[model samples]
Target: MYDAVEALEGRQFDVVYTGKGALCYLPDFAQWADVVHQLLKPGGSLYIVEFHPLLNAMGSVALPGDTDDLIIRNDYLEGRGAIAHDTTVTYTGDQIPGRQRSFEWMHSLGEVVTTLAATGFQITRLRESEVLQWPRFNGMHQTPKGWWRLPDEAPRIPLLYALLATKSD
Candidate 1:
């Protein structure tokens, strides 16, 4: 996985876009930042929109036979090592044919920004949103734009975030 981006170094880009379920799969953010830096030209920009680490830590929000309670079921920061997940069933409730496994790592908001900045990327903008692309909580309601968010009574917390940075010239 580390060598995958090395090939892309030959090509320079003005903008690199990545996010969502992407970061969790990556075991190392520093390596990722360095590789991304190598792919971009001087002053190039990198935009990332991902699920907040807090979202990964919380549990029982909206699952089968689960309540609406905000529970801390997992780590909010990386360093504990990879989290193994059963891949037999997908998040959409679809059943797969064979048994499979996958691993993920939680990257906190601070870690993400720090890694990028440490790689010499100029932090431009970071936005956190309470809305999610899917109904993550039992009381979540769909917005006008079709996104989902907790109801007025539920405590507001960021479920997703977008970060924008630029490489120094």
Candidate 2:
């Protein structure tokens, strides 16, 4: 529920961050762009560090059910509607007990970049690093340089990522 384009008529803010909260749940990119543009002040910066949407498209074999505690996926690729489940996520930090699950959309890395560029925000610095703060992937371990890429025996896939950019003056 946002009239982003209309709000741009006369208003501004120092920063417009759209990563951690419900914004990331946006089902439409064009609309999300509006919110980012209107909420940003002149020369202000926009930093979005979100979970890799591509990772969201994965089809897992995690156990299934509410009390059973397992996988929770909603066919976002089809977009019929969210087929939510009850399962708790076990992250490195905040490994809260219990089980609860929900549906999520998939946005490729390119999609994320293109969406921002289309919004008038210049790509300042794009860095792809392993999970730094709290890794959700079981295959992510820290290293001297930073979060190590190698999770198990061989390092092949990346855990999570971040994006940093600023609005052009």
Candidate 3:
């Protein structure tokens, strides 16, 4: 991450993209948000696609049995809480390996909005979707766009959201 920033530091850009990969693993959203704002050109836009915290809580580790077997099975009310799970994911040029250790911090729908607002971005749109690009868990209804959804459990609420913000022109 440092290398990527160093390459961009001092160079003007029109748009900056950030994703907390796998589980929105942003230990410090404020710091990253601040850096992204700094790199933007006047009238630039920031297109951020983040995984809903609920997806984070449900460990990514694939289960040997049904997909439901791997989830934390909680409503996912946003706040500070502890969830321990073995998440299966692929790392850059490497595999996460089965049973890798990972942690996630829950942020409510409102929390994401407020956090970005405090960072000085004007909200243009908050789009939601249940599209599962990759398999996050088992028992998900497959969609053409690769979204795995719990048709019976959660149809209205999405498992991910994309937020678009812009700097004051």
* Model number with the top TM-score: 1
Per-residue lDDT for 156 in model 2?
45
Backbone clash pairs for candidate 3 read 61-87, 61-88, 67-138, 131-147, 132-146, 132-147
Q: 2 or 3, which is superior by lDDT?
A: 3
lDDT of 2: 0.57
Q: Write the per-residue lDDT of candidate 1 for residues 20-126, one digit (tens) a residue.
A: 88999999889988888888889999999999999999987567786678989999988999999978887676899897788999899989999999899999999
Give lDDT per model, in order.
0.89, 0.57, 0.65
Q: What is the lDDT of residue 129 in candidate 3?
A: 73
* Model 2, position 20: C-alpha lDDT score: 42
TM-score of each: 0.91, 0.61, 0.69
lDDT of 3 by residue, 1-169 (tens): 4334567666767887766463245455566666666777777888878777666555534556534444555546555554444657544335565668766556666776787678787889888777666655556677766667766664354668888888764
Rank all candidate structures by their lDDT, best first, as comma-separated numbers.
Answer: 1, 3, 2
Q: Score candidate 2 by TM-score against the native.
A: 0.61
Off by over 4 Å in 2: 1-10, 21-24, 58-101, 139-152
Per-residue accuracy of model 2 over 1-169 as CA lDDT, tens digit each: 3675465665777776655434345667557765776677868777777655434543335655423211334332433444344556533235557775654445556777787788787888776654544444444567765554445454344335567666665
Each candidate: RMSD: 2.3, 6.1, 4.6
> Which of the predicted structures, 1 or 3, would earn the higher lDDT when compared with the native?
1
